[model samples]
Target: MSGDTALVGCDFSSAPSKRKSIVLAFGRLVQDRVVLDRLERLPTLQQFGDWLAAPGPWIGGFDFPFGLPRELVEELGWPTDWLACIRHYCAMPRDEIRARFAAFCDARPAGQKFAHRAFDRLAGSSPSMKWVNPPVAWMLHAALPLVLEAGVDIPGLHAGDPSRVALEAYPGLLARELIGRRSYKNDDRAKHTPERLIARKDIVTALEAGTSRLGLRLKLSHAQRDALAEDASGDALDAVLCLVQAGWAAREGPPRWGLPEALDPLEGWIVSA
Candidate 1:
């Protein structure tokens, strides 16, 4: 493995996720080429935090909301301090949180029931504003603190530790680029049909060959390749996708892919940072 690796992809699960706590993949860039190195499955947030604090040359592309819009935070009177705000958010009971958000939405104009950041429209839907996505609310609840603790600056989102850098990413951005609305992963056993397995293989091939439009590639050992292929469901594969994004971020540098300097502190960036 490259000792001074660059990017990592995290397939983030919101709180109470049935998925693994965190799936991290490592990568490096050589002569402008992106290579995947390692993929690790962390079973808890503590383990993930420990990894972040460990000594190594790395930048991470985590799949979580790095910030809420300043407008929303101010409107709700949430704490301005990132860590304090997240702690208060995590401590709130789900019902109360939901009710408050609902009230906030209800008070908005009829045409705009849910509050949206500028990027929300580009990203399809905002998980922060939805409930069915499950523990994502909690993901936002749990993750922001770690980002703050890591001290990675997120432009408008955070004032982070200078040593550890973090960028927001979504695997969907890359996946959609490859498959274009075709379903690639399913926890449902019924949905893990042979066709999906073939799709997984093709996706893997594209990643390994560095043919995807994301301008990235994956490096995997024979064992890792077999492991991904043998899994009947695509949970592991999806995690690998997150890993690829992570690898990209690590290699591409902090808040990788040219994240804007003046992003809305509350409204987070997607893959760029």
Candidate 2:
């Protein structure tokens, strides 16, 4: 990775539309600060894929699971290798994938309906196989194929474009570290209250102070800070959060990218988790 490379953070959507587009935060790491450059929205997956394919010397933190639970993949009799399993998983129709995952959940005990990757517990993220609520499985289904087709390098997972590094990122992990799960955003406009606004400001304050374990401060102009903290949906803020993780990875660099050295190839680890 070059020292002058761009850094990106993505807040992705499985089925994007005009109102619920995929948000991207573009920045660069300068010393210990991540300087927010601009924000862009892709209202279609085709655009997202095209953007991924663009010439890069960019490292990105994408808010989506790069792999599934080992137990789930094994029980489902899917391919074990990283790229092969992703291909197999991606080839199936969403309906079929949901059916398989639902069946897997049905067979398990009540409290343990979902099988989780170890990283899920570590990052406090939803199971990648979950088809509802957050619908992360659909996200993996929609996004990973594009990442693969773009030939972006996923450190400790896939090797392709060395300049375009992709790492799994969970914004909630960093948010929880600073705020302990205080709700900061919502898609439902009715639920966008002062409390959530305050939460966003608090997070921004913590990040500006470099209070998180990542030890990198955020540099935002007055307008940029307002844009991040004022968006009721939190999509923009989440993208910036992922950008912070991407900054951490870019700073650390190379084969590990701040990932654990012994990461399970099948269930890829999240960046900075």
Candidate 3:
């Protein structure tokens, strides 16, 4: 957690989303301020795992669900063991899983399709019990094994490699603070308008000026800045946002629950697991 640790912000995708892949943004805290280091786009879960396993002094704040709600796991009788639980979760076909989850939501009263805890909205931008929104299911699928393989001890969840610490981070948590309801990114070429570019510039300026509540200061290279602006699409800029998140996580240090700790085992980890 001390030197050269990488802060990572992940832009997660919902299931069946080919657009959904883990984007790794690298950064470190210098003199209590966050600084951008590098950026990489991980196109596959396996590739992300490889990056996690790569040797380095790094702690990542990934945009993924780190835990599940205790109630859901208990009620459904799913395995409490972290790996086993995720294995079961990932094993089920997407359609079946969605159907079951939808049914569960339907059973609930209106305005409560998914159970929610107060912290969910505060941190993950989702109800604590939602399987979508932040897409905790996909987060679980992408992150669990990598942490275990890294040998981190995620207390209350399971033990794993100690070198790597993965925490749940939602970019929206930070984004909302700077630009509420303003779309800063769009993958659709048709929607890449001047308005969105202005939003991106605003975000970039705020980061450079250290205006965000996270107290992070983003440092971008000339090339990086040019790349972010030149590309009509916002993919590069989005990656920068993700990078800022990673920098914040590295500065914050490891999860209190343990390196490999489960977020909720049912509800999932929203911000920090």
Candidate 4:
């Protein structure tokens, strides 16, 4: 890892379209600080994959699960090897995958319907195998292949094109540190209000001042900050949150793509968890 490597934060959508889709935050870490360069939104997964495959030595914090629960994988008789397991899981049709996950949930007690990857609990993120709510199960199915196809290295999970190191990241983990229990954004137009806007401003301000627990300041143009604040979907801000973690990880220069040495391969760890 080099200090000057570009960092990317991906806020992903498995099935994206023109109205609302995936967003990326591009940045560069200089000294002890990170500069949020710009935001890129892609209308389709193909476009996102193309961007991922585009050449560069970069470190990325992508908002998606890299693996499923170990217990789930074992019980399902899936491959134990990280790359093989994900590749097999991604091969199934969406409906069959949903049925299997739903059956697993139906067999479990309420409040324990989902089998979570270790990183999910560690980062307070949605369960990787969840088929509803956030539907990360489909996300894993939809996005992992693109990452794999792009040849980006996923630390303990998958070895690919080492020039691009990708790590699991959840923006909520960083967001909660600065504004606990405060919802900063909503896709629903009816829910967008002054309070949420204020929350976004507060987050941006804390990041710019280096007062957040992440210990890295973010520099952005006034218009850039304003654009992030005004977006009701919060995708741009979420990408920046991932960028912060990526920048911190890049500065550390961990050999395993910023992941801890003891991370379980069956249930990959989240970056900055």
Highest-scoring model, TM-score: 2
Tell me the tens digit of each residue's lDDT in model 1 across 67-171: 665556778999876556767787787788888887888898987766666676676536465555444566676777666565565644565554555677776
Candidate lDDT scores, in order, read: 0.65, 0.94, 0.62, 0.87
TM-score, predicted candidate 4 vs. hidden true structure: 0.97
Estimate the lDDT of model 4.
0.87
Best by lDDT: 2
Query: Candidate 1, overall lDDT?
Result: 0.65
Output the lDDT of residue 29, model 1: 62
Task: List TM-score per model, in order.
Answer: 0.81, 0.99, 0.80, 0.97
Is candidate 2 or 4 superior in lDDT?
2
lDDT (0-100) at residue 107 of candidate 1? 93
Once fitted onto the true fold, the runs of candidate 2 whose alpha carbons sit more than 4 angstroms away are none
Candidate 4 Cα deviation (angstroms), residue 75? 1.5
Residue 232's lDDT in candidate 4 = 84
- Higher TM-score: candidate 3 or 4? 4
Residue 226 Cα positional deviation in candidate 2, in Å, after optimal superposition:
0.5
Encode model 3's per-residue lDDT on 188-247: one tens digit a residue. Answer: 788888887888777777778888766778887877666676555555565566556656
The TM-score of candidate 3 is 0.80
Clashes of each: 21, 0, 23, 0
